[model samples]
Target: MKKYLLLMTVVLAALSFTSCMEELGSYEYMDANEIKIDSIKGQSITQYDTLRIVPTITQSRNTSEENLEYLWYWYKSGAGENAKIDTLGFDRNLNYYVAAVPGLYSARLKITDKETGLFARKEFDISVEAENSGLLILSDLNGNANLSLLNFANIFSQDIYYAANGEYAGTNPVGIADIDNAGTDLHMIAILCADGRGGVVTEPTSFVKISDYSDLFYVMPQPIAPEAYCAVAVLYNTGMGITYDFIINNGKLHYRDFQYAAYEPLFNPEVSGDYSLAPYAILNNNTLLFYDNKNYCFNILKCSYGQLKETKLDPVPLPEGTDTETLAFDPRNVGLEMVYAAKGWKKMDNDAGYAYGIFRKPGSTDLTNMYCLRFNIGYNMSMGRDYFTPYFKHSISGATDLDKATAFAMSRQDPYLYYAYKNKIYSYDLEFDKGKVIYDTDTVVGPGARVDYLYFRPDNESFNMWAATSVEGSTEKTGSIHVLGLGRNGDIVKVDTVYRNVCGKVVGMTYKNR
Candidate 1:
């Protein structure tokens, strides 16, 4: 059996996983006697089986003279009041349950503030489907409100993705990401949805926009039609091939209409068909850089904003069977030069510590004249980290090895690459080819700062980039953003703490110029 491992978020700092905290919402103002009824909130029930309806209630009496009270109203559409839930718990929680044939139902909330005289009443309705599908919720992140489904006792795992609009385009979404393009308010995102029958979760819409989304979108549509999307690779009727539907303005979703044709890759014998992994980056409105699946080759697709030109090919000769995924491109490299962490010891067929290597895209094809940054494969995982003792000079001698990094962000005045280790942030000056490690000072970051997400702000000076660190591990994702120091040249410069917002599992990070 093949063990499953997530490539994006690499080896994690292990920690205890806690049940997600009660993520709830509350009202702003309330009074004991004011004529106000808090909107009925926190109503959860199962499908046709066992139903647990727990609605929060609060009531108060002014001056601390009177006590709080609680009441629950449970009734059918036409029934008066035969079954009423008036029970309270030690923590003043109301737990009421009902079991009925799948249909419409109503529940009420009664709140009485204990210290002061205040009371309110509210009611809401819920319809339990024939069979409970899954619990769904919406989160507005980067203009995209994704539908996150939980508690489904079914398959091994599922991946889900959202259209630029609110529609869930791809299948079950296991992971989603967006990397900014040129001037458009857009980026590429993929949904790792599960394939109905098993092993591989077909990566559909290897890229999708987040701005164009909708609430009318359903994960499972009736009559069964493969949702029109961009596919990394599809097993069509004839055979398996690459497929992508250029999105026109989806009517159901009010989005911008793209003046382009939907794409259907007609197999060409002239070219060695390779479109397995779609990793393309649009540098601007004109230049497009992409890597085919297997990471064996890279292509630069040049085109006008309206028409895509012929793909320029280049062979990235790896150490025999060594495969690569996460690659970073540097815009300031003399030519189209970039770096990617390769696998080391796995290349037992090769030399010592020849695990991962950083190959530069010096010129187009022919990997003859290439430079290897690090001949070790240890940095292959998406979140893997290795620290160098304070004595390594050849590797850190003026920040030379810093070029073999995964994170790269560029701006008008400042452009830099980052190698996020366990306790410190290393910065390599792109112009000088030398790097420096930044330490947390009394005023800057903590002694051992762990960065999760990082980006460069185009408008800030002195501090060009910002770092967001997880407070603990992926679960207790306590993290904050700090400023970058540009004062010292060769020494480790400390950063300053500026913003803080603890995240949950700090999944992925993308910096939009906006």
Candidate 2:
């Protein structure tokens, strides 16, 4: 009886163990779909170049029974909140793509197990470089309205009157201003000082807008004046949705809009005398602030997009006994686009020329005292002096030695103010209040070359400074386009003479980024 009972107990125990093992196996079984993305790297290509995306995907569970769907999408990389993701295409295999523009792009690869409705996604970044990237040099054909175009990408190639109308007389460009409207870039070439032929002084002062490749858009008439062209500044009013072309003809400030057919003068003539020098103007707080050399004061003009108004801002005071004619203002400033006037005076009885800076705030309308630059001129500098000698520097030995600041071009994006001093280019750090020689024109081009004007590339990363160079004593009225790299310290990094022996002196040069 006892043996039979023990055998029964063992049988029961074995049956129970078998049931538990079967339940455990059922719970541990995994039927969920699994996928792994093998392509997680980035890519790089030039603008308009083709890109291929070959993705390797693997499914771990029931691979043979499952069908997968693939989707590809892309958008501008680092677009942040403004990113608008666009679908590239949908296919089982997305292997091709092309970016039509230059910028960083982000691409996504999505794969879904169609049967199980399970999906996985992977993303990558791509960089597209600009295709037509380099420089466009506007030069002259020696006193003729025949301007030459020298593309730095193909430095040796030359084209004359790149985009001129045969009906237009030969006009020397006094200044070139670029305005980027929406996505289209427009260049305003101020036609002035033309020898009696193509749109000369008698032909009615005017300017033409052209596309980046020198295609003509329209020719607009400027105020008829015998005054030599001083400067041309182009700016867009975001508020009123207007584009303004401000021109200084023989010291008078006049403006015209693309929407209008006529040019109009700004401010009343009773406020001051003829603006003697080119009006140095800049955009500040959506208003235009300019320096009036005749009055030796800074003035402000505002545009609401439809009409213009003057701020009635008081003029920055000039130094006592300093002739307003001897003072020149650099339109470029470190911050807020304020006006900085440089005045140098070497009295007939004195051997040294005293130079100093006068500053005004962007929106200030008070005529009270203007801020003065209390710093030294040369290597060694101390605080508190409102002026310094332009010619003599302690480190630059000799009498009547060292170049004085001649022409000025302030980096629109940096704190450094560039000036053509003594035939060389020097950069002055407004923050550090120190000056450094960036390029030696005597070495880059030749001695006796004068930089009539300087243009800094609006996009600062290129480290480029374009100068319109003219030789003082050259028999032929010729000029050259000098390109200098502003990246390195102490000396200029890259120097290229894009065009030489131009028929006429280069009065102005600017870059239009494509």
Candidate 3:
């Protein structure tokens, strides 16, 4: 019985082998098209520059080039799953003009064989830089507001705001603020004007208007008065950093936390306060120190839990073992009104220390009696009411014409507070309690040129003073911007660069980072 079974199995195996051979011989085989992409070079170009890429491709089979479909596109590098893919072209080569903002990108070429349904792809890095980036001077030109750019290459481009927007930013432009981390979409430039037009937020790279000032609020105020705009970075307890953009309109604080949504109407109710704020304020890590002009005192806005809560600063306290007579002024209830206030040189671990403000008694017309008040809001808000401390209160010394000064700026590199008075620039050394003339615009720029604005680039570590000046009697392109190099002792070393007669009467300036 076993021998008979072996025979049957051999017979079945032989039949199955013959069947497989016959099936194999009946089938036909052909080579499929395989795509090969050659190495493509990386690209580096400025915004608005043409980005051209010609790729070399080959196929393994004898397929016609017409049978292939091509796609060229780019997206922000490292965007991962949320990357926004922008189509560059749908051709074999790329010749796309880059209108994208300044950033790192990844350009890709994808070739697909339409017949074989096979694909090949190649990717290369691309760096897009701003074509016009540097100091942006917002000036009042011929009764209108204009924006000018002094580029990194030392070339000046005037009326950039008008060129891009086809209209003036607004008449009587008072200030410009760069929202470096406005949102994930892009940086923003807030152009503020006092001409009842409020302000406009524009794209940082192109100066293209994004929205009108009224559009930035959930419920617009009755009379729009945009005074200042600033974005401050605050670190939370969860180890996350959030940037909140603060807008001061008619002495009210309006803020938006970009982490929640992009450009949503700033949180409503404006900080729940009845006090009118001064036009100037200082921002520490998670706290905003604002002086209430109505109450003649200071208010603290502590940023936490994605909401701004008012923190009551304890009364100014004398340090342990210090003389009670050494106290200068009460920070919580300062009796004077602020004229100009700026962040000082002293910095704590997580906060700005010793902010200086020039103040005078309310309803007093005597500017010469103005006093310099220095104080610090403690670095740690967890300390509760103990955060407010007064440092110095004294009359400004060794400087003349305090009443005639138009602008004031403080140097973070040193204890020098600079003020622009007519045609001269004076520096008051806060540490030494002395003041002296730093630069004379009349002698340097021209005979009738007067300093109209004084600012130090907030990001620059060195003391490169920026002064905006104009002729006393003219408003038509009479503005000039100078970058003055400063010595360690707070003296002007030389005039490094100057843009003469570039825009209108300069009122405000801010640096635009690339």
Candidate 4:
């Protein structure tokens, strides 16, 4: 009871503080000017808990509500693609009296109907990161359940548990544990920063429900690093964070003390010019690509001690002629698509500059002849004049200093990268040249600095991500920790979100080896 009260009080106080904060002067109440969005601006990650949800919500008329009906939606995933999978029709204001489950699920609601008997339905796919997935359910610490593992990857057999199988019942078993008891395994283990609390299914018939404990996984030392926050589930094997550990425990995963190895790059900037570095990383069979906007000519950087070395994949010129900003290696080689951004320019592309392009080049080893993204600042980050790159190449480019290419951990999913800019997250589909918004702060920016610190846990099948939003002096006191759900077909679901209103600063997030 005491723990519950403390948690509630902390969350409520934070919520109040956020609401009391003043709005920026740049954004004022404009009665005349209006920015209308045909759909919700960016309904990226939704949540079940209201009070715990950091950014306070009031009202907004900036969206198009013509077709949005006052209806409810619920789905196992965030994509509202298949209505059947995304079941609809439920309570209007109050869906689940309490936050439904701790796992990530897709759901949204529309106001009232005006045109027809039904109102317009604005179904924006949202990831709900239940904030309490790791908290032990005090009421049922003894009641546990066991799950029969379906060896799709290794343990293949006739027995399998599908969505049709009444959802996974049985509690208080042994061996198996829930990284975080989110009620439903809507999120696979390590799908997002490790929930820590999950059911454990052991060989000798043992299981432990995730709801049994709050300490599913914990960082080893005094203060935990921010980057050890949330990790995206891609290749469970590769564990890395900006400044923390992607540790594992008894099959569960979370942050812990680990080794730190920093080295410098071996190569130097010898390209078309001294272009900003934009190295790329891919995950899930090159289906996704992440980029950093360093705009340096080189990509791979081996940091040893305080020195950094650049390992060149291709031979090029100097930092004089080119005006590019990023580079990438589609880990799967797939050679080229092996891409980089912002090429063919003198400097920041003074004359409206160049439009960043995704290109391909040669590679080392068996990584060749694949789809490589190639272009000079003259033809950068763009397919053609008709379609533009998601982001531009100019400083005028919305890219922030923090906007640099993200070096994906050395894993099977090498290229599907994770990065943040202006404190927003975007996942790129190299195959489709498409960008998906993972989290957005147009709802609430400032008072905090948003940086991308993602980590992956091998055992728990989850990853953690953190956005440092609030600060004091030079200290970061609050952050919205988000869990990324890795599911079928590069599908993403937000498991949960939490704000740490404590004393800490997010050091460049990276995972440490134990």
Ranking by lDDT: 3, 2, 1, 4
TM-score of each: 0.35, 0.54, 0.71, 0.25
Candidate 3 ranges with C-alpha deviation above 4 Å: 1-129, 234-242, 259-267, 310-326, 382-386
lDDT of 2: 0.47
Top TM-score: which candidate number?
3
- lDDT winner: 3
Q: After superposition, how far is residue 169 of candidate 4 from its true place, in Å?
A: 48
**TM-score of model number 1:** 0.35
Query: Which regions in candidate 2 have their CA more than 4 angstroms from the true location?
Result: 1-136, 146-157, 163-169, 183-245, 256-277, 303-406, 412-414, 421-423, 431-436, 442-453, 467-483, 487-504
Which scores better on TM-score, 1 or 2?
A: 2
- Residues 1-514 of candidate 1: C-alpha lDDT, one tens digit per residue: 1233553223332221222222223335654354345435543444434444444333233433235555655443333456444332322345444445333456565656555545566677644432323322222232222333222222111223333234543333223322222122223433322333111111212323332222113222222221222222211211222212221111011111122424212212122233432322212222222334334344443334334434333332233343232223221121324343222222222111232223444443333333333222222111112211111112224543243333334322332445554445666543345556654422354553455444543212234455555444333323444555554342335544354433322223322111
Residue-level lDDT tens digits of model 3 in 1-514:
9999999999999999999999999988987888988969886777787888778889998546999999998888767899899999998988888889676788889999988888999988887767876788899887787999887556799999899989998888889977665245445788988989787889887889998878877788757888887666531212233366677788887777665664444545476667777888777555567888878887766656445544232223334565545567766667888888878886656665668888888887565677888777565442343466777888765666675688888888788888888888888887666788888887777788888898887754567888899987785788888899888787999899887888878888887755
Give the Cα lDDT of each candidate. Answer: 0.34, 0.47, 0.76, 0.31
Model 3 collision count: 0
Q: Which segments of model 1 are wrong by more than 4 Å?
A: 1-272, 275-282, 292-297, 302-305, 309-415, 441-449, 457-463, 471-474, 485-497, 511-514
RMSD of 3: 10.0
Better of 1 and 4 by lDDT: 1
Error of 3 at 304 (Å): 2.5
RMSD of each: 27.5, 12.0, 10.0, 26.8
Segments in model 4 whose C-alpha atoms lie over 4 Å from true places: 1-416, 441-449, 457-476, 489-492, 497-499, 503-505
